[model samples]
Target: MMANTNGYLVGSNLERVLKAGHFAVTAELGPPQSAEGDVIRKKAGLLRGYCDAVNLTDNQTAIVRLSSIAAGAILVQEGLEPIIQMTCRDRNRLAIQSDLLGAAALGIRNLLCLTGDHQTFGNHPSAKNVFDIDSLQMVQMVTAMRDERTFQCGDSFKGPEPRFFVGAAAAPFADPVDFRPLRLAKKAKAGANFIQTQLVYDIPAFEKFMAKVRALGVHKQTYILAGVGPLKSPAMAKYMKSNVPGILVPDELIERMELAGAPWAGKSKEELTKDDKKARSAAWQAEGIQICIELINKLHQIEGVSGVHIMAIEWEDAVRPIVEGAGLSPRPVVTESPPLAAALG
Candidate 1:
């Protein structure tokens, strides 16, 4: 597959796109919280020239996104490979199927299928949650459409179905560990080509999850990505601890952060008036960073997990440094021929 004028490979679909390997890194370019095109375009361009691909989040955080497809089109204009994420919360099967075809026709093939957060989780509390299907089902639907050229309603191919590298989410730290292995297997069985895991903090738990997959012996069959992020502030830590699902913020870590921040959290704004420096650098580098680096190494060392997809969210701008710091090099960009003129009579 060759790059478009902006440099993103124009024809590279899912399968070839991920094979560049080496801790396959992807960063999210969330749609604007409003209809602001300039803001979204800026975020898209910020990460445009780097990373394996950019994920345009769909109504992420249940807030209104500029629509993943629209953002993706803009990213394509900017020359970034865009992964158009689709959620089941707002759309039903017909809509989901319709969007898949639309996305492909628009030159976006990478897909991240999410069951979406419930509507109550967002600012618009009155919005309805449409759980028409779970994440795995959505993956299955995409698989059928791509591979069999058919829809859930048994529609036959009028022409060709778009090829997609279908991805699903796995919350390693989310509620009920029993569900982890089961869901992973179901998603794999349902034809999920890859998985982007939830944010991971406890390396031991993360390792155990891998071990469980190993015991199941299907480790080599799926692409597993380890999600990592740095705590922005103590306030952010508190919010994650109380609100986020399937996420456990160890009390000790919080206490350590508090101690690191010392009087900062409690300090009056006046006290820091003269010093605008951060209260403290959250020690994400201490052992924790190494632990993730080790996990990346192990995932590489192991047979089942093909690669890791780093999700820094807004902090994604720091991803290249982390990947390099972890000793992985940037993937060589693919070359493309200049656009050809149409055949004449």
Candidate 2:
């Protein structure tokens, strides 16, 4: 158990890093669809020193995968801190609280609460959805569990409580965009210590959103980590721009990705050989990484932006270069706090 010598709420490394005022870096790691611990270890190896903490996604995109808490425990053994993502899409308050206790017991200190993707979006479209409590409510419930040592049902914990560094997601470009800031305020008011936003591509639009966030004074209350991802190819960029909700990719970036494949520009897909396609894919990925690095650098300059959450999806290897390119490598070293019992002694 890590103790908080500096009066941090949870004494997690992430809390210490952010409070120390160092520009923080966090990356996402999706658990494999199978129950393999080595898979988590492999991904952890790639991301170990590149970021402050790695987020273990909970059934991302509604696709079934290794449980976030289980993978987080694996990461704990690998000497890398994990932020277990908890979604309200599948569990009720009881299951949610129980899982929180289990996660904390296993030394998982940070948590990212989410509303989760709709079941209809996943492979199991026939599965019944559970929205017993929304993400905002989840935040509030977890805060109470930590601060008050009480369960959501008003039951008191007899012993140690789950003291977590709570987090929540933010979508600056979500529909009713004007209401985004107000929604963020609700989460902050509910006690989310940090906020990782949806992928940001349009800098100007994000700037406007931040201006609103600063005006509302939400930035002062919580650390904001802008979400950024590498576009795999021009088609990928176009798909995100046209299909993904709450993600706003600028046209300039799409054109940039298109330009990356210029060497094969005149050749149609049918005319290109395997090697040609492979070369073009490599070029596009390289350009994507460069673009991501640029976004991180620019996002760091924003007043309220505390860090960048790099989501490379299955391309975990890109994190190293992206972090290095953004001048955020050699992540800050904040010592873990002492255990509660040791601190009391």
lDDT by residue for model 1 over 86-173, one digit each (tens)?
9999999999998888888888878889988777878887987888988888999988887777898888768668667788888877
The C-alpha stretches of model 2 lying farther than 4 A from their native spots are 1-6, 336-345
> Backbone clash tally for model 2?
2
lDDT of 2 by residue, 1-345 (tens): 333436668777888888777799999999999988899999999998999999999999999999999999999999999999999999999999999999999999999999999989999999998999999999999999988888999998987889999999999999999999999999999999999999999999999999999999998889999999999999999999899999888899999999999999999879999999999999999999999999988899999999999999999999999999988878988775544432310
- Give the winner by lDDT: 2
Q: Quote the lDDT for 210 in model 1.
A: 81
* TM-scores of the candidates in the order shown: 0.83, 0.96
| Whole-model lDDT values for every prediction | 0.68, 0.92
How many collisions per candidate?
Answer: 5, 2
Q: By how many angstroms RMSD does model 2 differ from the true structure?
A: 3.6
Which residue pairs show collisions in model 2?
3-337, 3-338
Candidate that scores best on TM-score: 2
lDDT of 2 at 134: 97
